[model samples]
Target: MSSDMNKDWPLYEVFIRSKNGLDHKHVGSLHAADATMAIENARDVYTRRMEGNSIWVVESKYITASDPSAQDPFFDPAEDKIYRHPTFYELPEELTHM
Candidate 1:
């Protein structure tokens, strides 16, 4: 292979969604020259068993993750917002769908 092809391009995070699945779960990471190559590589490397119905490949540089150490402050607001929970509200007996 040419040196350009063998060179590490960029890191990519892979996510795979199985058949009839609603959400994609992170599988692994790999290096590729671009988004197109990332998807193709992810499929060949991670889905060789035909386990995935859909694949998502995101460049590692583009992902913005919350700081794990700030979890208390980051998630504290949701704890105080009890109204967001379904059990917080009592649906009338007439509303069976809820």
Candidate 2:
């Protein structure tokens, strides 16, 4: 309604999972009073064409993300764990997704 009312609402990040997709992708952001309102707003705004089957909404203030500037050091630990990778394994020809 008013600018001040919108300003008081919390910002929410919207993610949508398509009918054929296994993972949810960030679509956009919106302002809502709470999580329930965020979800309804996201569905109405993003899935008007029935593009997605699932929706996820998260408050912007609660999310924690790594700093892009410190990417190298932050992800370096994962490089040392080679066993975590699937490159060493060979998949059978019948494996469709692999």
Candidate 3:
């Protein structure tokens, strides 16, 4: 498609989960008419090698993120909550992953 027509399409963020990965990771972005098209495009473009087992496509505009400039203040509150840290508790010896 022409550049002008591609610009008219909504931007989508693609995330893929590999066979062994527990969480999906952002791979890249693409322009698509809708969510379905985004998934197809993402699969063809990002996972042609068949490395990923799961795919997630989300329109870029719908995502909200914290401002990078405000990172300290935005995440500072969590530092004061010591109980949220994993070091607060001891895991069993059998808990391999933890």
User: Which residue runs does candidate 1 get wrong by more than 4 Å?
Assistant: 1-7, 80-83, 88-98
Local error of candidate 2 at 59, Å?
Answer: 1.0
TM-score for each of the candidates: 0.68, 0.71, 0.76
Candidate 3 residue-wise lDDT, 14-97, digit = tens: 999997647999999999999999999998999999869999999999999989999998998898898787796877898997
Tens-digit lDDT track of model 1 for 1-98: 55676466878999999876479999999889999999999989999998789999999989999999999999988988887878967788889866
Each model's backbone clash number: 0, 0, 0
Candidate 1 lDDT score relative to the true structure: 0.88
Estimate candidate 2's alpha-carbon lDDT, on a 0 to 1 scale. 0.91
Off by over 4 Å in 2: 1-6, 76-84
Order the candidates by TM-score, highest first.
3, 2, 1
User: Which pairs clash inside model 1?
Assistant: none
The predictions' CA RMSDs to the true structure, in order, are 4.3, 3.0, 2.6
lDDT of 2 by residue, 1-98 (tens): 78998789989999999976489999999999999999999988999998799999999988899899999998988988988988888888898876
Error of 1 at 40 (Å): 2.0
